[model samples]
Target: MARTSVRQLHVTVLVLMLGALSGCTSITKHIGASPSPSVTEQIGVDMHYHQVLDTLGPPTRISALPDGFAFEYESFRIDERQLGLSPNVKFLRWFKLAYGTARVARETYTLVFDSNGLVKAFGNAREDQDAGKGLAFQFIVTVTQVVDTRYLDEWPGQHAWGVSMLQPLPVALNREQSLDSGEHGIEQRGTPTSSGQRTLEWR
Candidate 1:
């Protein structure tokens, strides 16, 4: 009876250890400055370029236009979730599996200035309808999910316990990627022209 109790305790300890080996982690990262509603309200068309700069701080990117230059202010909020599985046993200790997904929310404000340094056009773009579809962001998530699924079923031996054995992995169905997906949160339309004045388009 004492031997049976010892065996049961060992099993319980092993189960708890295995459970601890697998864990889920969440992380959040904020990039660039997010414009407050009050500050953004102060921006308007025909405002001096310097006014916008002074009001909203520096922009994330700048591009030269035919008539003038353009300033792009962007902010990103990224939330990432990952699940990691590792074997405590010595034989499979080297094996590790990790699956992760990142959701990126972006806000973009653009200011187009004329040669006179006056704002010709201004607009704001927010990632609402189209979020988590970015090339770089989605690519990483897809690779992790696919690899996680495939590796799980391809475990060695006649048992066959890798990704193939699992009918479906726990991946988010909403995560989608496309070749034509706009990498930029704010897209620019048409090419620069040598006309009287050029303006930027926001979609």
Candidate 2:
């Protein structure tokens, strides 16, 4: 019985060592991206819905709107690397803590379609950011901001084929645009008011 117990202990240690080795290696996870830039440029108002499906495959989410439908396609990639003491160097474990670095890249494409099955408007947004947690902060620092922009067929007070689509307040594209329009302050927090306008909040 003693010999069997010793063998089991050895097996457990070996398994743990292998796991540590694997963690030390960089790992990457990704989702779909096929048609590439061409598909992005091709998406425009009045484009056929079938063409969208053929170029980008099925959307990740779809919602039914009163006049038509909304389709959203999203793809993201995560890259991670483990640092600090690993089981391969068990002696260092007593002095060093495990930490890691990670990067996330995301892309979202949205298309709004009318009841006729033709695209009414489209938007594409992309983001890349770095993140780190735990004791790693002592050695690594990262700062990032997440921003999303949407382009619609119409702007404020604009109507499309008798349908009025609510538009968010215009966001200046550059210093020049801001100067020309003057500063338009937007509330970043608090529940939406009865006016039906939504605020932008960063996480």
| Top lDDT prediction, candidate number | 1
In candidate 1, stretches whose alpha carbon ends up further than 4 angstroms from where it belongs are 1-17, 128-203
Model 2 C-alpha lDDT per residue in residues 143-178, reported as the tens digit of each score = 221111111111221122123222223322222222
Worst 10 residues of 1 by lDDT: 171-180
- Each model's RMSD to truth, in Å? 15.8, 13.6
Candidate 2, TM-score vs. the true structure?
A: 0.49
Worst 10 residues of 2 by lDDT: 145-154
Query: What C-alpha lDDT do the candidate models reach, one value each?
Result: 0.54, 0.51
Model 2: clashing residue pairs?
none
Encode model 1's per-residue lDDT on 9-99: one tens digit a residue: 9999989677544545565656657687779899888999888888988776566666787877766666666665656666444444555
Against the correct fold, how does model 1 do in TM-score?
0.54
**Error at 33, model 1, angstroms:** 1.2
